[model samples]
Target: MTHTLVQDEAAIRALFTSLVEGMRERSPARVVARYADDAVTFTLAPPLLNAGLDARDPEAVAGWMAGFDGPITIEHRDLSVAVSGDLAFVHGLRRLAAVPVGYPEGFSMWTRITVGLARRDGQWLITHEHQSVPFYMDGSFLAATDLEP
Candidate 1:
């Protein structure tokens, strides 16, 4: 029983690592595979001003890959993960970078992200993820007012 549990943990870690790599590659197909067919994503952007939830069908998820103009990069830190039965969650700090339109150079942002995973049919997969940027008065990343949408 202990051996089986250890194996499960390793498998889950591998899957999560793959998912991160895929995100860095800006390959939506790889990212979508980590989620269930009916998985939904909520994005918090200032322009959107509200939490926008999108039901990710295969086509929708695949199309999302087209939105990136250039490669995406993610650096993870202080990663903590735990699994309970068929559910698992990972939390950590991330440095995210991407090239936006009209910008010759890319920009990087730091944030904290929490990912929720569920095991289905003995395979671990991500079900949900939420990212938040902490606002500090010390002028670290972004100010609290900057986060206002």
Candidate 2:
């Protein structure tokens, strides 16, 4: 049982690592491999909205990734992951690069991201994600905006 748990954890970690790499490489196909067939993704970009997709559907995943010109770079830290049965959750900080010229400043904003994941068919996959920016004003972390719920 202990060995099985360890292996499970290792597998989940690998799945997440691969997803991160895929995002950096702008490979939606690779990223989609880490999601379940009916997984949903919610993005908080201005004009906040929710979008749903099927992970097993490669065409849909590829189409969504096509919206971006290239992969977005990310640096993750303080990552914590836990798995129970077929469910897992990961919370961490991510520094993302801004979109190129003519995009809004928000597009260039670097922010922190939190994500939820699940395991199916003995494989780990991302099921949901939430991202936020740490508001800073005059070099100090603005408690009100930065810590707003």
Report the C-alpha displacement of residue 44, candidate 1, in angstroms.
3.9
Query: Model 1, stretches more than 4 Å misplaced?
Result: 1-3, 38-40, 46-68, 136-149
Q: What digit string (tens of lDDT, one per residue) describes model 2 on residues 43-139?
A: 4443353445543456754655565555566566677877777777777776655354345443434456677777666567777777776555668
Q: How many backbone clashes does candidate 2 have?
A: 1
Q: Where does model 2 exceed 4 Å of error?
A: 1-3, 54-71, 98-110, 136-149
Model 1 error, position 129 (Å): 1.2
- CA lDDT scores, all candidates in order: 0.65, 0.63
Q: How close is candidate 1 to the true structure, as a TM-score?
A: 0.71
Where does candidate 2 have its weakest 10-residue lDDT segment? Answer: 140-149
What TM-score does each of the candidates earn? 0.71, 0.65
Instruction: In angstroms, give how far residue 137 of model 2 lies from its true place.
Output: 9.5
The TM-score leader among the candidates is 1
